[model samples]
Structure formats: C-alpha cells, structure tokens
Target: MAKCTAVIDIGSNSMRMAVFQKTSRFSFHILHEVKSSVRLSEHAYKNDGYLQSATMNRTAQAIGEFLSIARSFGARKLLCVATSALRDAPNAQEFISRIQREHNLSIKVIDGEKEAYLGAIACANLLPKMDALTVDVGGGSSEFAVLRNGKVETLYSLNIGTVRIKELFFDRNDLAGAVAYIDNALSALPDFGIDTFIGIGGTFRALTRALMKKENYPLKKLHAYTTDDVRFQTFAEQILQAGPKKLKSLYIKTDRFDTIKPGTLILQRILKYTCAQKLVCSGVGVREGVFLNDLLRNSAASFPANYNPSVRYLLDTYATHSDHGIQCSHLVKRLFDLLQAPLNLKADYRHDLVIAAKLLPIGIGIRYYAYQRHSHNIAMSGLDYALSHTQIVLISHLLLFKKGSRSSSLIPRAGYGTLLPDNATVDALSAILWLSHILLAARINADTLSVHYIDGKLEIRGKHLYLAKEQLRNIVLPKNLIVVFQE
Candidate 1:
C-alpha cells in the first residue's frame, strides 16, 4: 500500500476527496480533505436519469482539482468511486470516459449494494461496535446495511432519495405522494428487530450538528454524538413541516434548504420503519471504508486485536521519547493494580489510563515548555476513531491535570464535567497519574520504584528519593489517602 492514499467519492450532491497517510502497518491518519457541491444529479432525475452536460462538466472540473490536491500531498494510490448518481444515470459512461481521457482518473461506478457495504464497513471499523442498521441517504438513492456484533450482515438500497423524491414528487408539491413513494420502496425490506440506527452521509450529519447546537452539547465532536429516537423523531417532524424562514432559525444552512426536507423525510420514515430507539451519528462514510478496505485487506478488513488506529497514529507521529513513555505506561499500570481496590476505579478504565500515560509526553515533541497543554489539545482533537466522546474527553482531561491539581475543580471549570465519571473517580485516577509522574520525574528506571497500598495509606520505596519526596509536597493526594516514600 502507498504511504499516502487518496479516496474520492463522487455522489449525486457532492464531490469529496480524503487523503490518508499511513504511520505503521495498520495505523493511519487523514492528512487532507476537500469537498465541493458539484450536485452531479441536479437535472438528471428530472430528465429521465440522464447525465446532464452542465453538471458533468462541473464534476469533471472538481475531480481534476481533487487529483491535483492529492498529488500535492504525494498520494501514490487513488481510489475513486461514484454512487447513486452515476449508477442510476443512463449516460454515466460519457462522464467516466471524459474524466478518464482528460484527467487520467478512472471512476468506478459501484452498485447500491457495494456502496452500502462500503459505508457499513467504515462505521464498523471506526465507531464503537453496535448491532444496528446503517442508513445512508444520498441525493439519488438511499442505502441500508445491517450490522450485527461488529459484522455487516446484509445490505439493501432503495430508489428513494432526496433529489429523486424532490424531482418525482416534492417538485409537484405532493406530500402524500412522496410519503407513499418512500413507503412503497421501504416495504420491500424485512424487519430485523434492530432498535439502533447509525446515520451516515451529509444529510444525517447536518441534522445531527443542528441538534447538537440547539441542545447546547458541551463536546464539539460529532462522530459519536448520540440522541434518543423520540427527540430525533420530533426534530425530523419539525424539519419536514418547517418553512424556509423556520429552517434558517433552526440552524439549517441555506445551502441545504432545497433538499433538507426530502432527506429528513427519507431518514424519518426509515427510522419509523426500523422502530429505531437510538441514533448514532457517523462522520465517516464510503471514502473511509474504501481506505480501510485497502489498508486492511490482509487482516480480514478488521484491525488487529486490541489495536486502535487513532492511538497508534498518535504514538507513531507525536511520541518523542517512546522508551520513557513505555516505561511510564508500565509504571502507571502497576500503580493502578495496587490501588484499584482502594481507589475504586473501574477495571475498564485501565485501558484508557494506560493509553493516556503512554502518550502523556507526546506534547514534548512540539515543544519542551508547557507541553501538558499541547498534549491535552492533541488528545482532544486527534483521539477521534473507535472511541466514544466521553472516553475521549476523559483521556484528554487526564492528560491535562498534573501535580498540585484537583480533578473536581479542573474538569468542571473547563466545561468537561458532564463527560466524565464522578468527581471522586476522576480524582483517584488523577492522583495515581500524578504520583507516577513524581516517582519518575528524575528519569529513574521504572524498575527502581516499588509501590504498595495497605489499609488507607500508600507507600513508595525507590532510589534517588530526594526529587520524588520534594515534589510530593506540591501535589494533592486523593481524599483520605496517604503516601509515604522510602529510600
């Protein structure tokens, strides 16, 4: 595989390109992303599913520019796929041939089933595992993939879409006709008794973003944001009934006004059909799936056991003193084992704690001074894949608090209290980390330090005790916990 690979998705409504750079065999990060509103199916749906000349020209130009950007980033492999627009069009070969001749780019026109599979695999590998139906509502068609226990079970695509419905029924101002058309298409799908829905593509993302803002969500990350079905259904109903002025007030962008209603209706009806109880918004789609499919072709399209792409990427690119980081991680784990019972920390938290400790010194690669802030910001933004928003926020906060800090004050004061465990839990975790930092501050070998907890007091015995003992005074211990250092 190329060190840097580019994946392009030419949809009915948008043309997007993402460039991913590999850090290790199975670790990678997105380097650049570009999106253009080409709207390739603009007049095609109304004109008997024939590719229009004007939209084709615009799409060609965008693809050409995307290729230039990809080449600028030294991308050696390019995988470009076209979805409903090209597959439904009668004259798609004309646009494909033109792109091939002019820009030397080959566009693979994928069927609806393959398209749904791509989107499903992306969510399966990138987001937290779940058993649900993945809904991808595009401009020309809507695709569904059934995922069970981190595996894709089935896939289906419907002829109903935002642009298709808009041209066929909504343009005629026939609301009942639109609903009937959607229901007719949906009737072919069998119920799977799945109560959760994973929404993909731009329409779902836009709606979820608006919901996030209206509810004053603290976390800015959108990938794993979750909401109950009742709230989402109400919001979708309001969108269907909202006028142009009302949509603007609801935070719907002006660019999406024309097709938002159709997309919302498609999504709302599907949610009803599936009897969805929860909605998990997906920020990844076919493009990411394409990359992952190629990146993990040998590994059965799944990451190695116990491996996280985002964490590996962080360690690969940012970790300066990896030996120390590894040592620190071991020390923290040992400390966690000794204090887990007394501190009452959950066993599941150990994974996150180890990762945070291993990457704590990554900020030093950027600069030596005030590196903790850098580490905090990097963790908040870069730990995006395969983890929930709460875990991400908690790990970032754990990296932020060092010696002489109280987790209760720092977390709530920094607006992340809602995303963390209770104050006592956080303080215990923070205290363990702080104590580890103090023990290793003198760059002593981790083997030189030993820790044990008995009753309510914690004892540490190590060589070069002066620095550890001195820094211990400036730090705050967990409530009712005592630390005694010995040489």
Candidate 2:
C-alpha cells in the first residue's frame, strides 16, 4: 500500500503544494503538484512589516484549494509552512489565526535558520554525494547552506531575494549599487566553504530558463544545470541592459520577467564573491526539505531499526526491478571490461555504460516502434531524485544505441555544456549496452555468461550462451567483434 504525504509551502511570491506517494524504501513518486503566484510580499514594505489584507485573502483561497486536493489524494499527513514574508510580518499571528479558524489548517512560520537547514537536508538526501552549497532564494529572504560530505557544516539566511532586492534597489539602475547591496549582505555572514553552489527557487529557475534559451537546450529536465563564470556573467549583463521589455521578447515568463534581472544580479554577486566556477540548479527546495524532515522524525520514532526514509524509499523501488537491471548491468560491464584494453576508453566511461544497461528495458510499457526513443525521453526528462543531467543524457544516449539509433541527433546538445562525452566513447558504450540487452532477451536466467578476451577476440561463455541458437539469425554483433559461445 502506498502512503501519501502532502507539503504546502507558502512563499512571499508563490504558494506550492507537492504530494509524494511512498512507493518503496527510498522512493516516492510525485502524485500531484500545484503552484500559484500569490505575491504575498508585494506590500510587505508598504504595510510596514505586515501582510496586506488582499494578499492574505488570496493566499487563504489557494491554501483551501490545496487542502482539498490533498484530502482527495488520501494523504496520511500534511505539513504547511510559511517562509520569509509571513515569518517577518508583524501581524503574522493574526494571519495564522485566521487560517486556522477559516481553513482548519495550522501554519508554521519557520525561522530563516531552520529554513536553510531544511534546504540542506533535502539537497543532501537528493544528491547524496556532493560538496554542495544549497541556496534558496525566496521573495523576502535567501537561505545559504554549506554542505561537506553530505552533512551540513554551516548555514546562513540573508535579507536578499528577487522581491526583496527589487524593493530595496530596483530604482537604482547603477550596477555598482546592486553589487554593493549584495556584497554587504553576504559579507556579514561567517565564511561558508566556497565550492559548487546549488541554486534553488524562482531566481534560479529564471536563470536556468534564460540559459536554456541562450543555448537552445533541447531537454526540459532541470536536474543537472551547470553554468561557468563567463556564461553566467554574460547572461547577467544581458538581463541588466535589456530590462523587462526586452526580457519578455526573449520568451521569459511574464510573471518572472520583472524580478529576473534582480535575481540574476543576486546570483552573479554571490558567484563573484565566492569565486565559484559553476552553478548547479536544484529542483528541490523548502517544501521537499519540510517533508523530508517530517519523514526523518517519524522514521526515528516508529522504526528505529529501519531509519532513513530516502534510503528506504530507494531500496523499495529498486527491489521490484533491480535484479534484471543488475544482471544486464553485470553483462554490460563484463563486455566493456573485455573491450576496454582495445577501445582505450577512460575509467569514467564505464559509469555511463552501466547506467544505459540498467535503463534500457525501462520503456517496455511503450510501443516497440521506437521504444528506445521513449526510454531516452524518460531518462532526459529527469529522475525523481539525485541523478545529474549529464548522467541522464549519457544513459539516454546509451538507450538510444540499443535500438541502433544515432544518439547525436536524438539527444539534446545544450544541457551537457562542457561535460559532453567524446563521440568515440559514446559509440563504444552504446554498442556494449545494446549487445548486452540482446543477449539478456534470449535467456532470462543467463546470469553466468561472462565476456572475456581470448587472443584479441571477445568471447561469451556460459550454458545459456551455448544453448541460444537464435544468436546467429537475430543478433547483429559489432563488426571486427568475434563472439565464441562456450558449452
């Protein structure tokens, strides 16, 4: 049975609800998601640190709709959080009281420190292995978390955001003013280890959109977006000079265009000050963090022996289909190992090849006409957690090769950036995964088959390999590759 949990995040600029259905040990499928731009912080300055009546009413209506959806989905638990604007508002208690009385929902206004900590937890669990500085930019504030070896080292929240910055320095067209404001805000905080910065929230999303347009990125996945200093600076300058009217022309979303410039400026300032080479865009944020924290607490209390929700979910999802995937992966690896000496490929190439082998059969549900294409589409579209963009592209390309398709034309060019693999490596890995899939289809229990080099020839040995007579007619082995089946 699938257990569902709903998390509603009320931000200064928008309100979002994410419903996660527990599928397996560490796997949760996103059941439903809804976002509405309420702009609660629009009048924070005018109202002198209080939420305005109009914004509060709209927010209440949105939350009511979100609650209905959550109940319909049969969510076991619901977590509602208000950040930045609501937390800072002088009349926040009044707003909370009204929400409880009218909607029967209690709103927890979390402090900036807790917000930053939760964001870090989500990133740590999502990526698992990375030295990341998680940054969440909201309407009224921005949370920065420095993580080392998947553990939070330090965190800080600043009074800087798309809406907050716009309110403070929107009138000042001078680039120096924006830079100074950003520098001053960041300088006060204790030093955070400078490494790869993981950007979250609206500003980061807008920056990614601008980069995607500039590069003509074909893939819509936001999992692994890496931008160098030069590219970041170039886009920042363009946004600064063109203003909102010109930004709209570039197809930037209307709701975000007005704030994008300010947001970009903030990102650029942080990057320049930190002297980081690249920015990684993370789709996960405060809402995910909130849900994750709740799960962790529950897991600790209820199942002390089996703690860690993320790991549990991952194990459960993989248990269903991992055996076949691992079998194919082993065969693919053995084949690649045998050919590695001859192909002279680097060590990193093996990772891409193995991932391709695992994901090849994932598209069996779709029609076989272009099932490889469908598999490739699913991989490039982004996985639920942690898998990077480059990893997805490589896996997608490998799947494409299984169908004897040209990966260059099918895979998107822009999302890869500088990490794009060499053509020779791509070709070799594709061939290896395709052959493994072909061999596996013939014998479901063919786990003993091993690929090894015998006098410069690739040979497959095992009882199943010897018994499979259809290999001669159905299988098309790569040229110059000799396959010897041993009885």
Candidate 3:
C-alpha cells in the first residue's frame, strides 16, 4: 500500500485539508478530511495588498494544524494552494515569504484561469461523459470553465464570490445591486454554448442543502441536482426575503445565512444567461483538484480508473437488488422504445428514463412495506454514486409510479430545466415499467420484453410475460395495450 497524499487549500472563506491513501490498483481511500472557517480575506479589503494581521494569524494557525496532521498520518507528499484573497493582497509576497521561512511549507498562489482549469479537471474525472459548464464560487472570485467532451474549451475567472458580495452589498441591503454586480462581471466572458452546468464551492453546496430540505430529498449525497424555473424562482425569492432569524430557522448555518441571498441570486443569473437546463453539484472543489493534480504528478500510471465512483459499481458492491435493477433497466428500454412514437419522448430523455428504471429497485431492499417510499428515499439521498440530482429525482419519480403510485409531483424541487420527461411521458413509462416488473418478477431471465405497433394498436410480447395465465386473464390492459402471444 502506498502512503497517503495530503493537500491543503487555504481560501478566502475557508481552509480545508484532505488525505488520500492508495487502497489498491487504481483505487484510493479517503484517509482524513477536515475544514475550518478562517475567512482570511475577512478584512483584507481594508489593507493595500496584504491580509489583515488577525486574518493572517488565523490562517497560519490553521495551516500549522493541517501540516501537523498530515505529518502524523505519514503523508509522503503535500501540496498547499492559496487562492484570490492571498493572491490579491498587496503584501502577498511578504506573507508568502514569512510562511515559507517560518513553517517550511511552500505555498503557491494560483491564478484564476488555472484555478478554473484545475476545478474542471476534478469535475471531468467525476463526470467523464458530460458536456458541462463548471462554475466554482469561492470567497473572492468565481471561476467558470466549459468542458466539452470532457476537455476544457474555455475558462474565465470573475470577481464575484459569496464573501465578496456579502462584504460589498449585504450591509446596504442592496440585493439588486449585488445581482447587477455579478451579472456585469459574468457578462464579460464569451458564451461557451453550455446546456449543463456543474457548481463547485460552499455557496453551491449551501444551495444544494437548501434545495434538498425544501423537496425532502432523501439522499445527503451531493453531485448533480435538477432545478426547474419554478423551483429556482421560488427558492431564490424565499432566500432573498428571508431575514437571518427566518433563515436560521431553516437550519442553515448562521455564518452562511447572510451570503445565501447573494449566492442564490448569482446562481439564478448564471442559469438565466447560460440557458443551462440541468445543474450538477460536484462535491469535489479546489482541494480535490489540487489533490488530484498531486496524485497525477506522483504516479500518472497509478491514477484511479474512475475518479468519482460509479453508480453501477456502488449497486454491485452495496446494493442487494443489483440484478433486478439491471433487468428493470433492460425492460424499461424496450418498453420506452415501443412507446416512443406515441409518447413523443426524445432520444436523450428516453435514455435517462431507462437509467432511472434500472436504478429504481435499489431502494426496495430497505424495507418491503411502502417500498415505493423507500425507493424514492434512496434515489434522492445521495448514495455515494455518480448521479446528477436530476437523474436521482427522475429515478425517484419512476420508483414511486413503479410501486403502484401515480404521483408525478413526487420529484424533488431542483431546477431540472427540460431534462425530465413530460408528466404524461413519465406516467406512460412508469405504467409500462410497473406492468413489465409485475409480469416478469418471478420468471425474469435473458429473454427481453418488447412492445410494437400492429394494426393501429400497441402490442406487447415476451416469452414469460404471456406465461402469466392469471394476469393475462384478470389484468385489464389499457385501451392502447394490444397483447400478442408468440409460441
């Protein structure tokens, strides 16, 4: 086993340390993770170029603690990065010199474009196939990088972050002005033609937490979440109007309450201008990016195969109904194709629907009674798998319908844009998936269930599906259903 590698990220709002220990070939285990709210840029604005004395002292103490922990854990390599706050301070060089001389730790102040690129690398490792607009919102600046086909095409760094906005606009209670400031800063970047957006940093995480609570999301996992225009508008308004007292009631950390308003507005503005339909919340931020960079630098050949764990691997490793889930996915794809003409479902939407169908059964193993609810619960609760929030919401909706329920409104309250299938389409797919599961639960095997158009009617055929004599006789097929037996 290889020794752990640690990376320390000293940011304007927070400082964090993470350690990764090699577990096996192309696999690593997280050894330790810790974060502290140092807010090094808290009053750095008052000074010409260096962080205020108090802020610098607090940051140095945090770094010392992190370095001690890394050494105790026998970390062979350590990388420390400081972002905007330290980079912009007039006395940055002096501060860096003092830290290096006193602490024996080399600190690199990364530029905005490099920060955006590194963040994108971390995201790309997580979602290999996505065409994403990666947005990292930090204390002093927000970085944006467009990943087309898993490669960075464009990147920009803007002077807009939660702490920056809070310092500039919150005291005046000028919410509109804050929004304008963010919009103006972001407008300078050329459009990247992005349809999907991935958010990184504390503000994005805070937003995910708020959306999870509002929709009663079951999973605490953070990856991709879907937010619609309605949900976005509603939540944005709520956050804006909420006073500290009211916000605290929502269980948001007191320190985060003030920044939530401006952060939400910034996100809203990004979504509005980019026309992104889906938002993926990556838990990995600058720390993970830096760690990954070090990992690759140390041993490029030993890099993990899947940077972020996969849903399939998770289902196989931890889930009990993995086999059944695969069967359901296969069945759903067949039925989806059969009804595509009548349902008017686009190819991309159908692909997501099939994925939802396949993953639906993972929740049933929790408990038998109200398996529908359990299924819904598992899908939304971040299961340490690589799934966007929208995909999870869609899967939860399908699971609800699969268990003999018809509530299409059970989906979470994230902005999913147009990524979800229409209600009618979802209903139709759910009905077919449920019927197929009920028809083949006992006799499921290699044979595939299929639907077809025959003589102006939809027809279903499967070796085992027709063998259910009781269901064939008693089960009432929908008006559109036409059953055919193949001997």
Candidate 4:
C-alpha cells in the first residue's frame, strides 16, 4: 500500500478529491481536499441522458488539476470513481476516454448498489457502532444502505435525485408528479424497522450546517452531530417552501440554490417512509469510503477492536515522548481506581481520564508553553471519528485544567457547558488528572510510586520523590481529601 493515497469521487453535481497519508498501519489523516462544482449532469437528465460537452470539458480540467494537487502531496496512488451522471450518460465512454488519453486517469463507473455500499462502509467503520439506515442523496440518484450492528446488511439505489427530480418534474411545476415518482421509487425498499438515519453527502451536510449555525452550536464539528426527526422534518419542509431569497436568509449557499429543494424533498420522503427517529450527519462520503475500502481490504474492512484512528494519528504526529504518555496513562487509571471507591466517582469517567493522560503531551509537540491549550484544540477538531460530540468536548475540557483552577469558572468561560458533565464531576476528574501529572512530573517510571487512599487522606509512598513533593504545593486537592507524601 502507498504511504499516501488520493481518492476521487466524480458525482453528478460535484467532483471531489481527498488525499490521505498513513501515519502507521490502519492510521491516517487527510492531507488535502479539493471540490469543484462541475455539474456534469446539468442538462443530461432532460436531454436523453447525454452529457453536455461544456460540463464534460469542465470536469476533465478539474480532474487534471486534482491530479497535480495529489502529486504535490507525494500521493503514490490514485483511486477515482464516477457515480450517477457518468453511469447514466449515453456518451460516458467518450468522456472517460478523453480523461484517460489526456491525463492518464482511469475512472471506474460504479453502479448504484456499489455506490451505496461504499458510503455505508465509511459510516460503518468511522462512526460509532449503530443500527441505522444510511442515506446518500446525490445529483442523479439517491442511495440507501441498511446497517446492522456496525455492519452493512444491504444496499439500494433509486433514480430519484436533486437534478433528476428538478428537471423531470419540478421544472414543470408538477409537485404531484415529483411526489409520486419519489414515493414509487421508495416502495422498492423492504421494511428494516430501523429508526436512525445516518446521512451522507452534500445535501445532508448543507442542511445540518445551517441548523448548527442557527442554534449557535458550541462545537464546530458536523460529522457526528445529531438531530431528532421532527426538528429536521420541519427544516426540510421550510426549505421546500422557500424560494431563492428565502434560502439565502436560511444560510443556504448560492451554489446549492438550484438543487437544495430537490435534495431536501428526497430526504424528507425517505425519512417519512422509514419512520426515522433521528438523523446523524456524516462529513465523509464516497471519497472516504473508497479510501478505506482499499486501505482496510485485509482487516475485514474494520479497524482493530478498541483502536481509534484519531488517537493513533494524534500520537503518531504530535506526541514527542510516546513512552512517557503511555506511562502517565496507566498511572492516571491507578489513581482513579484508588479514588473511585473513596470519592464516589463514576467508573465511566476513567475512559476520558485515561485518554486525557495519554494525549497530555500532544500540546508539547506544538509548543512547550501552554501546550495544553493546543491539545484541547487538536482534540476538538481532530477527534471526529467514532466518538460522540459530548465525548469530544469533554476530552478537550479535561486539557483546560491548570494547577489551581475552579471548574465553575472554567466551564462557563470555555463554553459548551450544556454538553459537559456537572462542574463537581469535572472538578474531581481534573483534580485526579492534575495530581497524576504532578506525581510523574520528573518523567519517572510509574512503578516507582505506590499510592492508596485510606480514611480521608491519600497516602503516597515512593523514593526519590523530592520533585513531586515540591510540585504538590501548587495543587488543590479535591474536597474531603488530603495528600500525604512519605519516603
């Protein structure tokens, strides 16, 4: 496998490229991404499904530039797939040959089922394990993948899409005809009894992004952001009723003005048919799915058990002393175990504490001063895979604790207060984490210290603990607790 692989998905409405560089086995991060709204199916739906010369030329030029950009990042492999437009076009072979002759880029035209499967693979592996129906609305087709227990069960694709519906029925002002077409197409799906809808592609993302802004969402992440079916259904209806001016007021971008209604309608119909209870927006689509399909070909198309890609990428790229991070991670858990029974702390918090300790030094890789702030930002932005928004925000908040700071002041100032646990819980967790750092400030082996909580005081017994004792002066112990250090 190449160290860097570039995956391209040429959709009917846009052509997108994502370049991924592997940090280690089964771990990688995106290096570059480029999207061009070529609208390759602009007139194809109405003109006997023949791709227009103008759009084809525009798409070819964009692909040429995408190739150059991928090479600039030293991408050693390129995987390009075409969906909807090319698969339906009568002159698709001509366009494919042109790109092959001019830029030496081969495009694999995938069928609707394969396209749905690709998107499902991305959601199955990258998202937290769930039983949901994955929906991907493209320009000329809408795809569906049934997921069961974190695996893809089946895939279905419909010819009803934004551009397809717009040209066939919406343009003629025949709303009844459009609804009939969508309903008839949806009748092909069997009842899966799934309530969750995992949305993939641009249409879902654009609508969700607008909602996030309207609600003043604290976090900037979109991948795992969730919304109930009723809230999204109302928003989708608003988009359907709104004209061009109203869409702009709703934060719909100018590029999406033409097809936004069609896409929204398609999702609304599917959600109603499937009896969806919730919708989770996925930032990754066919491009990411294609990349992982090849990358994890031998590993049952899934990451190793309990291995998080974001964690590995952070450690591989940012951690300067990974061994020390590992040592501290173990020490924090030991401390948490000793205090859990004493302080009445929930055992669930140990997960965040362990992860926080392991990633503590990630900020040092950016700068020695205030590296914790850097770690906080990195976790918020980079920890987008497989974790919920709450977990992501809590992990970042853990990095905000200083030697002596109140969680009450820190929680409000940091924001995202609604997504976090209570201040008392956070204060306790922060105190444990900070105390662990103090104990290992000298980078000593974790085995050197032996700690146990007895009655009201936590006993710390170790040799050569002079530096730890000195660092303890600035620390604040949790309420109803005291620290006793002895050599």
lDDT of each: 0.88, 0.73, 0.71, 0.89
lDDT of 4 at 340: 87
lDDT of 3 by residue, 191-291 (tens): 77777788898888887777778777655566655556557667777777788887876556787875677777787887788888767788887877776
lDDT for each residue of candidate 4 in 1-487, tens digit (9 for 90 to 100)? 8999999999999999999999999999999999999999998988999999999999999999999999999999999999999999989999999999999999999999999999999998888889999999999999999999778888999998899999998889888899999999999999979989999999999999998887888888899999999999998888999988999988899999988988898999999899999899999889989999999999888888878898889999999565777788888999999988777788978987888888888888888798888988888778879888888888878877566666545775546988988877887887788788878878888888899888788899887778888988666677777999977
> What residue runs in model 3 are displaced by over 4 Å at the alpha carbon?
297-385, 389-487
| TM-score of structure candidate 2 | 0.87
Residue 68 lDDT in candidate 3:
91
Better of 1 and 3 by TM-score: 1
Worst 10 residues of 1 by lDDT: 407-416
Cα deviation of 37, candidate 2, in Å: 1.6
